[model samples]
Target: MSSSTKPRRGLSALAALAGIIAAGVVLGIAELAGAFFRASATPVIALGSTFIDFTPPWMKDFAIETFGTNDKLALLVGMGITIALLAAVLGIVAFRRWVLGVAGVLLMGAIILASVLTRAGSSLPDALPTIVGTAAGLLALRVLIARLRRTAVGDPAGASTATTAMTAATGGRGATGVTVTEKDDAATGQDGNEREGATAASLPSAGTSRRGFFAAVGVTAVVAAVAAGGGRLLAGARNNIAAVRDSLAFPAPASPAPALPAGVHPPVPGLTPFVTPNDDFYRIDTALSVPQLTADDWVLRVHGMVEEEFELSFRDLLDADLIERHVTLTCVSNPVGGYLAGNAKWLGYPLREVLARARPLDGADMVLSTSSDGFSASTPLPVLQDERDAMLAVAMNGEPLPVEHGFPVRMVVPGLYGYVSATKWVVDLEVTRFADRTAYWTDRGWAEKGPIKTMARVEVPQSFASLEAGTVMIGGTAWSQHRGITKVEVSVDNGDWEEVTLAAEASVDTWRQWSHELSLESGLHTVRSRATDAVDGLQTEERADTVPDGASGWQSVQFTVK
Candidate 1:
């Protein structure tokens, strides 16, 4: 803590920074190596997924509510910042107490190892990259700290007697026989104060060692930056699965949907499009990154509680008799009146026939489907086997599935919420029971069976829209999927409900467009909509948040009439 000891402490601090930077470089190199085999093999991704798995439901909701589809990217950025800060701390600790630093690095590796092991289908080889990266970090820390320790600039005021004697013998020069400063007072016949000042100024300051440490840091940082860029490039190159999907042609559907009526979607401005484009579709899932899978490498394994288990390749799916149907899919996390629902024309084989081939046992009451990235959903066995057109879909809206929407294949069940039914990149289906197993969200406090609730949204006359006073057309979409919307009603300022004209229903599995015209005099007007299902099931009026199951409430929007 002495003034003369400042330079040595400063050098130690620099060494610690260098150590951290070097460790980052080592890990980056390891990440590049892992990318050649699989993108998911990287340490950060494994750790991120583990963090997501353990995150509480409310925190997960908070992230989704805050970042929307970019929540995963936000999580990765947060994790990166956390890791960098921890690494810097470890580097500093290692500079002063190397043993503790080494221990910390090993502990970090152990945590990553545990994360990898906990992942579904993880093998022993999955741990090798993290272990190797951690060992390299430890080595870098050791080398940098050792170089720092060898520097001899600790105390300028207290140069040893040997140092003074050596300086005098060499005529106020360094022991290396080089002139380091002006002559000491002993040689120049000057006072003690002058000699002491000259001695302090002339001492060899560990310049060579400091320069070497800085060079190491610069080179390591540059290399890490290059590695990161290269890793991203390689990953992008590996994601050519989209090209493969585009090249292949979908066969004619054995059972195609009835052509949609022309006026199915009203021309009202701001109304939700009848068919949500593949790119504009809402995506809410636990995957931190999209899985890049080509049809050639895709495979589905059907087993568990079945008389005969079987594996179906992507080619097999293509060859199977495919049907096309229009279905509306909804996310369980969608709040009432949320835009997390979409209607699409899907092409695939009937999921019931696929299960029938496996001959599920009588007691088997659920089908636990899993994605290539290890996400799982448990669909009710009866729902899947029923004549509701539940399917293993391979195409959406006349094109192959988009990579972000599940490239090779996915499950599409009309009535159930996507959390329990629509699984993307689906690879496995284990026939089981709710008592014996659970899906991802189900384990996190959601209902095991997530049925879609009837809901209506006023897309036109969106909140705060300005319009001229007189007749105003209020149009929107209402979906009860499978149950079908029998009647839609609109109300202004919580006034008496008025029935709206319904467009021709595409099918029981798709949403219907409805509209109503109201005469307004002036100022602000609050409009609300509600729907009744085919079975006369009235849409719930009380509002509810999305949790344990789906949300329910009347959709309302306010607007102004000049």
Candidate 2:
């Protein structure tokens, strides 16, 4: 390649690199600044949360189905790639026209600033990190791009001088002093290749500029990494609520859940346990980062459309008469045969009692429960006031609520899908009509009242499994939530359904395990299972997507007998 072309290509690449490096500096500095404020004040977290708030329901369902618990991680990775690509473009543009690059960076900052300031409970101070970070990024970009330009200008001139010195030293002769002619140049394929020789000679001549540019890049990268790592460490130290949670001593419940039956957990391998462990519970929420809140500072305000407004502190909740119940929570986005449902023993005060103290107005039909992170759920007021064990849950199993699940406090209502009922890190309860306000998911085209559908799944003899040819045991768990699963029936390859033995029921609100032993011949076979609820409601056989409400359809798995 010609010396001019080589320098141009290198400069372009360096410019792109400068842009990427500048973006890293921006994020690192922003994160460092955010350490002084709330975690949501960080530009990436704020932007990611905003994106989640505006995402369509279908898209949200797709993400949960595609990535399960790692949806947030996937989103962050996707955002990082997108930002890097855009930054690279901005860098190239800045190299050619500096003003446009500045405009692009400023525009991104504006977007981030808006995301930070518009967050729930956000103040003007929350935008400081974004503002400061953007300024630092701009400065970094300016300095790096300036260095790249200098290199571009210096490389060609240095190459020309080096070529001239080399020609004069060689006296137009080969390295061994052999005479060179146009015919020899043509024969050796060196004809019209003076620029190539100049390009080769430019390597040492341009070493200073290359070294300077690379040194700046290296330093910037190191600083960015240090800033980012230090910021994360600082944030973790500041928001280490885990220590506080672990130190908490929860009072005994006024009413406790009944002792589990002997056969509640059937001796079936691969079947979901009757009580999902705290760590094994399914988590499907919009929180990018778990909100860190201490029990001492937590306060819940109950107001709006009420005869009396009341504020409940964490201490007050702990002192109140709490009840424990084994409740199964389901995500509306859980696909058929999906594992987005879990049962756990929850302990907390009754929501009905809490709302009773406030005396919600007669016309109020919804209770808009909002999280500390600004996510809100519009639940039916009647559901919270009903005879069900719906409560302001504070502890799961025997321990304080896990931070990710919702430390300090969260709502737990049986039967209803989590989107409409469970509001983790709950801070505000506004009683109002559903017509007056829409929740985060409801605004995104999901059903405002998300009641979980009765569904059954086949766990053992998994899909496409090869099994021994004798009597094979088929087992799984089925749930109808508030309406207990009374029977589970299994059918083989479109054959007549046979009743499966149901394990002892834990409660009307928890799922039941079921297993059936059937003799099967060799070859492929599809097993389908369906459940009947206590109210004689049968699990639907028609397939429907998990939109508007929970999914429906009997789950079927195919296996082969060896």
Candidate 3:
């Protein structure tokens, strides 16, 4: 490559590096500023949340299917890559066209500002971080570009003085009678001559400019790293809700769940535990970050179409006659045989009693439950008021609710999908007609009411697992929460279905474990299982995608017998 071409390419790369560094500054400073306000106000969080809000249902399902519980992390990583690529482009653009680059930076800031302001409970103060960070990034970009330009064309004043001195020393001529201008051009490789012959006197200024640009980049990177880390630390320190949750004490339930029956958890290895541990419970929600809240400061407000509006404080909720029940919660996005269902012992006050005190209007048929993060679910009022143990849950599995699961308060309703019934970090409930409102998922085209479907999964020999040719135990769990699993049937290699030994049922609201012993010859095989609910509703054999409602199909796993 030509010497001139190489320098230009190098400078362009430097420009892109400058852009990336500026972007780092932008995010770091914004994060630091957000530490003083709210973490959700940061540009990344706001944008990620906005993206989630606008994502199509199919994309959401794809992400859930692809990433499982780590979907949020996958989204953040994707966002990071996209932003970095865009930032590099912005940097190169600014290096080439200064005004357009500035405009791009401002436009990004405006977008982030809109995202932050549009968040639930957002106020004017939330825009400050975006504004301040954008300004900082713009300034950094301008300064870096200036240094890069200097590197491209060394200090004009210094070059001029040096040229004059050379001309005077050479008497404005060379051995070839060439003009000083021509000699200088040749020396500087302006005419495609040798670059090694470049004047030594002209190198210092260009070298200094390059050095200064690199130094600035290094400093900016360090600042960005420090700011980002410090902001995270500060935010964590400010949100001491986790500590509060850890120190909380719960009163004995006025009505505790019955003792679990023996054999509820069969001896079969790899079977899902009867009671899902709090840490292992499935969490699928739109929250980009978990909402941190202290029980002491938490309050639930009930209003809209009610005879009388009432606010329940955390203290009042704790003092109420609480009830504990074993319930299985399912996500509507859970594909057939997906591990998105879990049974847990929940402690909370009955929602029917709470709503009874509010005295709902005659026409009200739905309760719009909203999370602090602005997610909402439309639950049928009759379901909450019925004999079903729908409750405003405070604790899970005998311990205070984990922050990620909703610490201060969450809603737990058996038999319904979480998209329509289970609301974590719940703060408000509006009694209203289904016609009067659409929830977060409903607005996105999910069904208005999401009843958990009867389903079963194979767990003992996982999909694609290999086992010895002999008698093998096929164990799994089945659920039709609130309807109860009556029987589970397993079939091998599309053979006749046979009844499996069902574990003792815990409650109508919890999943039942089932296992069957089968002999297998050495070969590849597929096992399928289905469940029968208490109402004799057989798990469907037809396949349906998880959308508009829950998924329906028999779960089949293939394994190899050696």
Candidate 4:
């Protein structure tokens, strides 16, 4: 509002900006320190994961639909922006009122601490970084605010006198100011005003404080950048677990899969690949950062409701007799005909054999498997103990499982949706009961038992594709997992359904490829495909949203014939 006050406000604003940078520097240092402990336990990641865990099902679906595989990246970006805005506000508030700023910082620390504590494997030590970082941020805010306060508007009368005295002492102008003071009492008001103005002109200006604040902020920013870069480097160094995975090899399967029969893959263009490649396989999990566990340090513990509790090291798992089989895994969240299903050749020890050793009590009907990162799945004990090829997979598609896909070891149970069966980075299998406990997804409103619904997906003549007006090849893949696909039928424009040529069945646990040909006329056409499973279960034609358990419906695609 006043000419003298404008520069003071500008300086305070700059100081506020400096305070924000200092806060960032403090957090960067905390993250740097945390790299040596547990990298995944950092405040941001822990809080972000907690937020995701509490996210509602519709929002999850919306995110998947909107950002696809980049949904996690989008969430991180949103969190970063939200944090930055709050930090900026805190900085400005601290500059105005230091106590309030400190309270805000502490509140943030409490939130982060609470989030960390609730995490899967977190302990009191995980709160150390956030606590230390908050303290540092509060100190930085106080120091920067103190420095800026020197230029803040104060008692005008006292400030003017202090300024004049400082100028006279520093510039050796005491004589001139003293002489002017000697005449000022008897002089007219105008002359007194003129003398006061002269004194004010000779005093220090606000520009100096502004310049100093900027310099301090610049230095703090550079240091923060260095610390952030160092943290990344340290985290990267811990990623050597990937190299260990590459060098490590699981033992040959004692009961190898049967040899593939000829004509397993249908000779149809645009048909889905019979076996989804490891790299292209769909991954939908709760891991924001992949847990890097070296095989030497990895251990699996089986306990709870078991007559005999046992622990197995990674070496022990590799030494056990293993079996290789092709299994199709599906996500419960996958919509009818979605791409979130993949068939892979898995190599691992049979889950049934391992559970047999544990000897789960009869009362317990579920195995609550948990990942190293804290994600949990409630798998039916009967499904795992049955003659099915449920296993603790060590390798996928002849290679060690990708870190993102779950390295070291993961579970692969056929017939069931991944929400209840495929536990990655698996560490503990607690033989429990469905009545006594629930899993991560189950608590979030998903069904306890997730079975893969029979479905057929069209791979060729995708929705909105333009095809030439002639014989058009309609090809796709159908999957029933435990129940093999018996027949695939295609219907054109609500017309009669016709059976498509089905590929030879490899095993009941994998998907089947099928194709059909159709004579088309120019215009738009809606084509749908459905499959009948070996047990007389037909893929439903009614549409249903993927939730609770799984989706059921015929997958329809519309294309124009040229």
Q: Please give the lDDT score at residue 255 for candidate 2.
A: 98
lDDT (C-alpha) at residue 264 in model 1: 88
Q: TM-score for each prediction?
A: 0.85, 0.91, 0.92, 0.86
lDDT of 4 at 170: 35
Measure candidate 2: CA RMSD.
7.4
Displacement of the residue 384 alpha carbon in candidate 4, Å: 0.9
Q: Write one digit per residue (lDDT tens) for candidate 2, span 348-442.
A: 99999998999998899999999999999999999999999999999999999999999989999988999999999999999999989999888
* Candidate structures ordered by TM-score, highest first: 3, 2, 4, 1
Report residue 14 deviation for candidate 2 (angstroms).
Answer: 1.4
Over 4 Å off in model 2, which ranges? Answer: 1-6, 157-204
Better candidate by TM-score, 1 or 2: 2
Point out the higher-scoring one by TM-score: 2 or 3.
3
Off by over 4 Å in 4: 1-20, 139-212, 268-270
Q: What pairs collide in candidate 2?
A: none
Give candidate 3's error at residue 375 in angstroms: 0.3
Clashing pairs in 4: none
| Model 1 steric clash total | 0
lDDT of 1 at 404: 81
